[model samples]
Target: MGKATGFLEYEREVPGELDPLKRINAWKEFAIPLEEEKLTIQGARCMDCGTPFCHVGRLISGMASGCPIHNLIPEWNDLVYRGSWKEALKRLHKTNNFPEFTGRVCPAPCEGACTVGKSGSPVTIKNIEKAIVDRGFQEGWITPTMPTAHTGKKVAIVGSGPAGLACADQLNKAGHDVTVYERADRIGGLLIYGIPNMKLDKGTVQRRVDLLAAEGITFITKQEIGKDITTEALRSQFDAVVLCGGATKPRDLNIEGRELNGIHQAMEFLTRSTQSLLDSELEDGKYLSVKDKDVIVIGGGDTGTDCVATAIRLECKSVIQLEIMPQLPLSRQPGNPWPEWPKVMKTDYGQQEATKLYGTDPRRYLTASKCFIGDANGNVEAIRTVEVEWSKNPQGGLIPVEIPGSEKVIPANMVLLALGFTGPEGGMLEQLGIERDERSNVKSELDHYTTNVPGVFAAGDMRRGQSLVVWAIHEGRKAAREVDCYLMGSTEL
Candidate 1:
């Protein structure tokens, strides 16, 4: 789709990032954009493989292999290479509702599945995508477009995260009155609070929200279902209801000293930090402070990385991340071949900053927290940890087996649990009499998204459990189509 021999001619190049030491001083996005000419050359690296797996958007061995929203990667790459920036933007928007969000934070499984990457470096698809969309906004090519006509049907979407926003956008485009309800004081759900400002600035999220509002989707903040509003009232008011409320029940460590005063869930730490930052530049002291305190972050994922970065920004004395799993290989193992999301060592932004400052990696692999030790004042003072080896249980499933004489105590005044979420909170689900799957997710079929209730639907993290923002958008768009079909007997969405 790009130059026939562009893959051979051009080496992959991505945008530069600010030095970790300097960037850690402030909470802002630090990725510097590549020039248009360089981005064009990078886009030319998109090979014309007969079968491009970059946009396959399927699971391979339980991991995402490509773009979850099925972005038209090659077409946009070709457009970028041809210097047709406007056309590239249009192609990008055809599949993705918010490229800015995914372009910034998505792990980019699309790059992992790139055809050229099988042999050499892959095309800079993520960077080119961000460039196209950023240019679209800069050139004033993107704007709010009101629906041509109104269907006079109203849809109430619970939750204003990516899923609910995408669903509301699609339903509104179908001429249905769409109103998004968020429990938080602001919209954008996870985008607003769950993610730290350093990764994705709140301004970017709010800009998109503003555009959606201009397009006629109503947004109501600080309105929670089952508490502020009842199920019966919502169903009676709207022609259909879609539950895009995310899976927010965080998994907990049921060990000794779990009730320590200084221990907190990852979301609570991140959410309060962002809120206070926005409210008064953090001078209000409404958020948790780890200044000059040793911090221990549990679980090894994006959330943990974010906690580490936030702690560093807050001037913590020291930070250490605990991971129960073994360290991944430096490159793809034979078992995890091409197109499968590579399980490899990644030094994310947080770890990079930590390495530069501490002269060592902050992660401690194959380590498990035994218990949190507290001071006489009831605040967490330290943590007891143990290294373990993976062993197969009777059922042939792998489990962490504690290694004897490996226990160690580390000083820690604060602990953040980044163990991820279990499932959706049960309040609204229970109130609506919705059935739940074994994993406690909303019981709804893929591509169908209908619950046992006549017009009640579900999508995103609520139905699929915690997932990438791209997947949530895909679910929302699909669910919107189903709701449109249910309402009018068929849909063109």
Candidate 2:
């Protein structure tokens, strides 16, 4: 709304990324932010649409369409266009607790649902968002807003991931004494360990964690609720307990030669690599090395992309990604139209890096791994794959059917299973006796987020299964409101 003809005047522009070949040499964030003047032009591209779909957080065809946290996209864009970054940062922080994290790592569904994207490119909302928050941090506008009064009610959050962090932030704002427990050696469960440093810098994660600590929120690391401390003890100590332990039980590939040595779960590999890099810069030999080896990553998703990027950094001789499903169309198909999450092929940063180095995209669509072929030492040496065709099963569902005479073997010294997670690990749930849904996720009502137990609540990946960081923040905020109501009789979160 800053300029009526802004969309007509300005073409969509986004932040530039470092050269693929140059960026692959180190573990650092590669995206170079746009200057203020260019970002103003990008912000002007936010049209004055009567119904801005970019801010309407909803599910279209079972996929997210807009900002999951329902960020005030248009308002911030207008502010950014008019050179009111302080006001823009205020609006950005109103909903999302961690804009920096989401701005960097989130797959922007907001752009997919952008009103401007119907004909031409969408507004660079993601880059603009990053700019606002980054400026807030640089100009020293962001600070710890400690609560004026404590409610005398203590709440325990069992996770240091996005969900738990958001919940604790909101609850602390509501004057409740919030304490977070993380099982990992450091805070920021997946943020610090699971994500590669190249994507979301660990320093950024620590900065936010430190800010939360300064806000009077207590964070206890290396302490698990069900293991080191009993659930009964936690319940006795705190008035309410919110479980945000992410869905960590990774899905496995149960095939021939499943017990091979070089096959590792994506989280295990990513976690170790990050930990080693932080500890000794990979010189301690703590993480599994894939240097000078042919790497094969199974399952085509974000994690798979991360694995490919990690392998490239490790100086792997070659890399390939195996995906069971066929590749999506380059653009939206006939059945898929506007306002829905586009089902199209997206070459992520890692794939782009691999393509730059190997002269081909690492992903292999419509392929299924049959079995692992190992050497005499029992380490994975090669993998047998079969081209698959999608056919209608009797149950009226499409399933992968292996094509006859399409079997082939590919050299692979290391195989990383980037398959998605199943659900939360059962140890904590079992100890807490929380109910689980059909998907093995902690059973909690969508809006209420209340578990079967009266004082216990669940949110984020634990309740909703594996999801984006933006959704995790939304869940955390919603759950915090519900927990506040339960504790104080009436809530004002």
Candidate 3:
């Protein structure tokens, strides 16, 4: 701790955002970076707890409570407080390979599990994390730690998302020749396409990708295995293969009129929008624009929130989000307890923008969509929905029961299905003869990422279904160790 009384002296301070009305009118990042001196004061607030539960990275009450990658939070906090940014970055990278991505998107469970949070607010760990890595990149202090010699072992990573990239990074550092394959036109999969540019700039992603290329990691784009290139070729060419293919199959809304033109999957909408912005100046591309359209996004998750923000940026005529669950309480639940992920109702940046623009929160709580109503041209024009009530049934289980008089129709020219993902696409897994779990995800044990076939491994969404970026990095690191141990008769990876 910088000062023994620092926590008492400093109240918690989150980064300020751009004026709500002004930011809602644009497609740029809304949160302004904190000044370095202010950030240093925030960093000084860390008590450096004796136990330091912030880095525990464990499962509690069926949810993750701490940093999943087990980041050295206290060490880095101390480093930042001492104005040792270079040291802070080194500590930051000890576990995480992509802090820039996680810093922006992760919910920061570490803050929830913080020992300092037991009585008062937690340290500004996430802010300091982003600041450290961002400054490192800006100062040109981050560079490739290229291997001194190659072990002549070739490895093929079958995805370009966070999991695949992290696995490739660890393997490359271990002297294994690494190659990443992406079906998308770009290198960073979800980072470039699945996520919005305002949250994670594509240029920031490309900057890292460029360095990885300079360090000899070959990126093969527009090359899809089991389709463009056969799985047989992958097995025969690479000494070892790590499948990091993410869960791309979007969960559907199996209701009436689902085949209408204006209705589309959440990934389709998100990907197209990001690509369009990244290459908007170009003439030849397809992207769904929500201009002057009535948008209805079905689902209450992060994807749905993203749809709301993206649509707002496009200046939609109006927007609404539907959720099957009732609005949660603003404060934490007694059942949830401390150190467990607080299941409280906190508005994200996107929803805050929606509320500011619409004069009320756009999310319709305990609401469910029943069917799509389309216009004469077979284009979606509206959606039919119902309000629901969730209560414990006789069997001691909670279920959503619809209310009698809550049925209504909402105008919607575009309806995005942001429900969620079921599992990874099985086409390539079928070709590799990889069995799947009950959920249709690649079959693999939690700590053991090996497949039924020797020298074959799986990680990330493919192995563990859809999850957060921190989990992806964890799974990738473990999968790299498993692959490295297979390549050499050692356990050092």
Candidate 4:
């Protein structure tokens, strides 16, 4: 709304990324921040659509259409256009507890739903968002807002991931005494360990964690709920328990040679690499070193891409990503119209780096790994894969059918399974005797986070299946409101 015809005048511009070759030499984030003027122009591209779908969070065809946290996109874009960054930051924080996290990691569904994107490029919403939050910190506008009064109610969050942090932040805002329990040595669960340092700087996660601590939230690390402290004791001590443990049970490849020495879960490889980098800049050699080794990454989602990128950084000899699913089209299909999630293909950072280094994309679509072939020492040496074709079954469902005579072997000294997660670990849930859904996710009613066990609630991946960090934050905030109401018989959240 800043300029009537801004969309026509300016083209979408995102932050410049370091060259693929130059970036792979180091693990630091290579996305260069945009200048203030360019960001203003990018903000000016926001159209004057009466019904801006960018901020209207909705599920279209079972896929997200806009910002999951429902950020005030138009308002902030206008603020940025008018040179009011502090005001934009204020609006950004009104709905999102952590804009910096989403801005960096989110795929920006809002841009896909942008009105202008129907024909041309969408506004650089994600870059503008990051600019606003980063400037807020630079200008020293962000600080602790400790509550003036206490409600004497205590909340024990079972994880320190995005969901847990958002829940803890909201509960603290409502004057409730909140304590976050993390099983890891560091506070941030996935933000610190699961996501590599290059994507999300560890210092950024720690800064927000420290700010929450200053706002009167107590964080205890290395405290497992069912192990370090009994579930009954936790329930008895805290007024309410919010389970944000996340869906961390990685889907396993149960084929032969799965127990090989060089086969590992994506999280194990990523977590160890980040921890080692932070601990001794990789001098300790505690992580799985893939240098000069042939790496095979199975799965094509973000996790798989991260594995590819990490392997590239480790200077692996060769890397390949296998996805059982067919390759997505370069452009949106006819059925997927505007405002629906675009079904177009995207090349992530890892794929780009692989392409630059290998002279080709490392992704091999419609291919599934059948089994891992190991050496005499029980270490993975190669992977046997077969091409797959999708055929409609009797029930009109598409199923993968292996193509005969398509089996091939590829060198693979290291195999990383990035097949995503099934659900939350059942240890704490089993100890608490909480009910689970058909998919093994913690069962909670729609719009309400209360589990079968009273005084215990679940949210984030624990309630919903594995989802984006933005959805996790939304779940956390919504759960915090429900918990607040349950505690005080009302809520001002």
For model 1, give the 10-residue run with minimal summed lDDT.
444-453
Q: Which pairs clash (backbone N, Cα, C closer than 3 Å) in model 1?
A: none
lDDT ranking, high to low? 1, 4, 2, 3
The sequence of per-residue lDDT tens digits that candidate 2 reaches over residues 317-402 is 99999999888999988788989988998899999999999999999999999999988999889999999999999999999999
2 or 4: which has the higher lDDT? 4
The lDDT of model 4 is 0.94
lDDT of 3 by residue, 80-156 (tens): 88899998999898899989988888889999998778788988888888989999999999987788778899999
State candidate 4's TM-score. 0.99
Candidate 4 has its poorest 10 consecutive residues by lDDT at: 1-10
TM-score: model 2 vs. ground truth = 0.99
Off by over 4 Å in 2: none
CA lDDT for candidate 2: 0.93
Please report, in order, the local distance difference test score of every candidate based on alpha carbons: 0.94, 0.93, 0.87, 0.94
C-alpha positional error of residue 233 in candidate 3 after TM-score superposition, expressed in Å:
0.5
lDDT value, residue 66 of candidate 2: 95
Off by over 4 Å in 1: none
Better of 3 and 4 by TM-score: 4
At residue 408, give the lDDT of candidate 3: 99
